[model samples]
Target: MKRKILAAVFLTVTATSAFTGTDLILAAEKTEETAVQKPDMEGIDTENTKIGISIYQFEDTFMTLYRTELVRYLTEELGFKEENILIEDGKNDQDRQTEQVEGFIEDQADVMILNLVHASAAPQITELCSEEGIPVVYINRQPDSLEMERWEQEGIQAAYIGADARQSGIFQGEEIAVTENQGDINGDGEVSYIMIQGEPENIDTQYRTAYSVKALEEAGVETRELLAQTGDWSQSQGQKIMEEALDEFGNDIEVVFCNNDAMALGALEAIREADRTVGEDIYLTGVDALEEAVQSVVDGEFTGTVFNDYFSQSYGAAELAVKFLKGEETEPVTLIDYIKVTQENAEEILELVNS
Candidate 1:
């Protein structure tokens, strides 16, 4: 249909965020360093090597910032023209994402990166792309291990580039666990808490929800869960959940664990509205050390957050895609690190992000 020399390339940014610091960082490293063996295809390359990307939703605040950084990364590497970069918003719809994938294949893109609306559907997508010889790089929402295994077994040129979500959870939990009160507010040995989760289906949500509480208990505090429900990563949902939880549990709720900064901010708002003071009456924590969240940690309104380092993750994903296009053997998976953001390093991290 469309005149082409080489084939398609797909680069996915799962950045609903994806980095790091701290001695707590854990990475599953895959080493790939070799010479580029240029393909003999007619399409050697061009300045406008079409790059297609599909993100879960544009409304995600962290992903917005992440995609901005990703664009800078790809532009630097590909000199990609504005028109050559096509970004489709799945808007949390699976069918919309499926349609977008079909369109990308029809257009015969050079590369694509996907942040899937449903990571479980990755196998079907991968099979479809492999048939057309398109390499996929999945970012934020990671597919199942079995799906990844299939890709590896079939030698499908697909790679998953993101940080370990479990690390973020562990960091968030450990941050709260180390707090002065240790999440035990009422002089009772129990750490009573509410969990404001992101999407229930997302692995990040599951890990953060479980690990935050696990960390508290591991640090020798007896934990009592008052409530744990999905907030779907929305500020309003988080606020509503916190308000209801406060009303229900009253002074018994010692800590609030939001899976991300948006929910943490929402919980903070509810705490202030209810006239309960943070760092005094209750404690709160979240993942994604967004600017406001970091500032809150500094201001003593929040316990802390896990710094989701978008810069390094996006850079690695984009860098790998370029290597793949140049016919270089690239790692099938790239794992980055996550940092715990607290008053100790909040200022430094804020400056780092701003810089």
Candidate 2:
């Protein structure tokens, strides 16, 4: 008999729900079903099942840490053989990623986990995987609208697991609002700020910026749009933009809200070149609690940041794939929770990541 897979929306549940009774035994812990059901692993033929992961790029520290932890947990912790996992890097190219997915399909991979470089390119991959009866799980980025609608209709084995970019932005903005800026020139209770955005087409950029603007407005912070440039999630690009902003706004710029940690680091470089001290002369905020970002927070370089928990994301996606393969039910959209990381909690976060 063919396995019957299920899909349901349960936003309040956690990632631990992806295992089954057998999985619990293997995991050596009885996880609560109220959090989220674990993917059924019975009769899965683990030795034969193949899983493919397509990521944007492994150059970034965040992606590297996640990939390392995921491989470790999935192979060592979950008892899957290392050879069964195939990882492909897109080199930040959408076409290349699509081709990689095609190759995975041709190889008859049982499941494909994709972190799309371009959301619009997702449909072709989804359609190809669907035609071959292979499950597709989207992570970190939102797929295009039409593709999402079709995936729902086709009952595809898919789940979205990532941070709510908008909410993360709101949190960043709230941090900036309360940050005292002694560098303000006029001392009129207003501060100048610059935004370093991620890739132009990235959905996170739009949502994060929008929610940040909302929070800034609510806090009555007068922000000058000195520089709103796309960093392409590149540290070098961030450095260039920050340099330009420094040349334009000088010490008048009190805050820098970067879309990710790399850009924030770039901004830090620019600030350093200008002889401005971070955390003392100006406040810096960024998303993606990369190890460097956490370290920076502990070192007093940044004010704070939001943690996307990439390890949890990978484990959750793996669990979801197992569940889909087992004919178990899951939600179409599974957004993971995010945590705020500040100096006060940096040690705890560092411990978690290190652990």
Candidate 3:
């Protein structure tokens, strides 16, 4: 089994690394402020304010934590009535999500939190809410910048709140780039990787898929594309696709890159079943430091993953929503930074996820 001699490099997290690109955006200590400091809604009146949450897909691993934390913040921290917080699953369908937004409008929701199923439809969705005079706070998935600008021109109150996805991709790539052999599984002085993507229309998927490879190449490692396909961010889909790739590429498959941890978990199952050991004969990587995926990293089952920081992201969304509800000035786009997760801090990451 090949192992990374540089594995200990990141034992103590730092602002920079040997593989960091000059263009890469630096992560800030705002994560400190994001994790702690409960919101002070002392003067805010949420007595009858209705907060309608529209999730892109409830089955998604990361979104589940997001939605849970969002509700927890609203009720527990902000002292909002549980009955006033209405959440609906978009089920990954744009039309269904549109209908949900329409319902929020007709129901006269005080504010709406959106995780757009299709970011391309942000204009339509935003227009729907705008027509009804409802303020929107987008989370996780960001709408097009043009759409946002249009809203600003129309004097609409809307903003996108989430971590920069390009950063997540960079972190994902850095994990493999810093790994031993540069993730070169075949020992041929090159890396060959299979990519499991989420929905192609999703901006997060596009950035993660692109920047991950860009980061690898920037590290002076050559990569051969084995197979790159969408798993729709589903574990079953990930397992099915991995099974097919194994049959097609066999041992030539050196690495697996999943856009999110759910798909990575699925690929891990298939890889273990096929007797291809990760961090050994083969390697795998993903985002969203999910508990199972983080534990796998600790157990040396995965190369690494990026910690998506659901706690901070969820809180940031709620904070923006409160500002919207209170008619306060909020930034047009608030970007949070992501943390790279490896075996070095897997236990700490596991605590964050499990807690």
lDDT against the true structure, per candidate, is 0.76, 0.74, 0.80
Tens-place lDDT per residue, model 1, 77-147, is: 44567677788989999889989988999988777888898898798888778888888889988888888
- Residues 232-343, model 3: lDDT tens digits: 9999999999999998998999889999999999999999899999988888999998889999999999899987766666777888888877778787787665778888
State the lDDT at 89 in candidate 1. Answer: 89
TM-score of each: 0.87, 0.86, 0.89
Candidate 3 differs from the real structure by a C-alpha RMSD in angstroms, to one decimal, of 6.5
Clashes of 1: 15
- The per-prediction CA RMSD against the true structure, in angstroms, equals 7.4, 6.9, 6.5
Model 2 Cα lDDT, one tens digit per residue, 1-355: 0000111122233533433212322232233232333455677878878888888888866777767766765676566678988889988888898889988888878988888878777777777888898888888888766666676777876766665677778878877766664324446676677889988788899987777767877887666666688997788989999999889888777778899989998888988899988777788889888778888889988888877667567777777778777877777777665666777677666655565
Best-to-worst ranking by lDDT: 3, 1, 2
On the 0 to 100 scale, the lDDT of residue 243 in model 1 is: 92
Better of 1 and 2 by lDDT: 1
- Best candidate (score: TM-score): 3
> Between which residue pairs do clashes occur in model 3?
4-180
